[model samples]
Target: MIITKYRFLILSIMILFSVKGQSQDKFKGYFEPAIDLSYQVNPKYGLSFGVENRNVIYSDKNMQYTVKQIDLSHFSEYQWHSKYAFGLGVQYRIEHAFDVDEESELRFQEQIVYTPERSGFETDHRVRIEQRLYASVTKHRFRYQLGYTIPLAQKQANEPYLKFDTESLLEIAKTQKPELEQRLGVGLGWFVSSKTTLQFGVEYQLENYTQQLNHELFLLAELGIEL
Candidate 1:
């Protein structure tokens, strides 16, 4: 019986550790601000275009490490009925985020030599993504969206290459590392009148490496007129 109990305890401990090791797939609550413009061509069918910007600040007490995004999203709306709508859109994004800290890793040429001093290590630090999202909106302002962000550009804090295309290498790394820099969002909005509305919402970034952070807080109120 003692041996059986010991085995059970061991199994339980292993299971607990396994669960802890798994990544949490949820975003912490925060504030996100966004704005857009829409032009209504007719009642049933209309088209609109706008830009969305996100600024992400890490909740962790690290001043030097925060992620920010300046994204432009173009959107079109097709009203299927009174309670539903479908939106097709794509986003062009220019983003900047914190990389591995100054001395987290070491030199490419020699182990002990500081990478910065030796100038050998390829510290892939800065990254950029171009993403496309498809959204379906419900009448009460519930949106479910799926998107994929492809890496179009990247740069290290201090590194140079020779005999290779630097831009191409960055693009290649994007695929090799295999990141799904994706987002999922939910929110509520209020309609004040025919020409103006206010919306407030939250978004999440699901990344492969690093602990999943709440990332972006989007709060937006807009004024628009049907055109």
Candidate 2:
């Protein structure tokens, strides 16, 4: 129907604007235009994929949408009516930010791997990020994500040549063994119709390292069209 098409068009516009006007203070960068598509694999299952320009227009490269982690989700839902429902899913995230500042602000570059062993993991290393950012706002709503990763898992390498005696040394050797960066986030979504949603969020990361600390904050925008 004509009404349905109009709604989709509006939802798309919301995706563009939400990224710019969230808190109205700390978010003054990046409106990276992106294209997103989704498919219904089964009666109740769905999948989605998206791509965005690295240099988002109106965004600061120093404080823009650079990624550190990601999450793919499988969810189950309950519908109270066409207008409202709730769902749950599990997610995991790749770690970003290697260290933090004395003030606890995230320093982006320090997040790069250092040390001999760590350099290998950092060299052209990629994020196999997995995370579950929940959605329940049948109406316009927002949610925040908070998480942390910490010191050595206390494990030894399977490699024979690099046999280390103590847990501390092995962990220290691999700069990858960073104390967890605390993850903080908040986003808003508007339900344009029964199956279309527009979302936007801002996230701040904190890291602690041997030398000093680092800080970085990002504002992210997303568009989802449910099948």
- Best candidate (score: TM-score): 1
Clashes of 1: 6
Candidate 2 minimal-lDDT segment of 10 residues: 162-171
Pairing residues by index, what is the TM-score of model 1? 0.40
lDDT of 1 at 2: 26
Per-residue error (Å), model 1, residue 143: 11
Q: What residue runs in model 2 are displaced by over 4 Å at the alpha carbon?
A: 1-35, 53-175, 208-211
Where in model 1 is the C-alpha error above 4 Å? 1-31, 63-67, 79-87, 96-186, 204-227
What's the lDDT for candidate 2?
0.34
For model 1, name the residue pairs that clash: 31-217, 32-217, 32-218, 32-219, 33-218, 33-219
Q: What tens-digit string does per-residue lDDT give for candidate 1 at 59-142? A: 443323234445565655565655345555555545423223211111011001111111222222112222322122111111
Q: Could you report the Cα RMSD, in angstroms, for every candidate shown?
A: 22.0, 21.8
Q: Backbone clashes per model, in order?
A: 6, 24
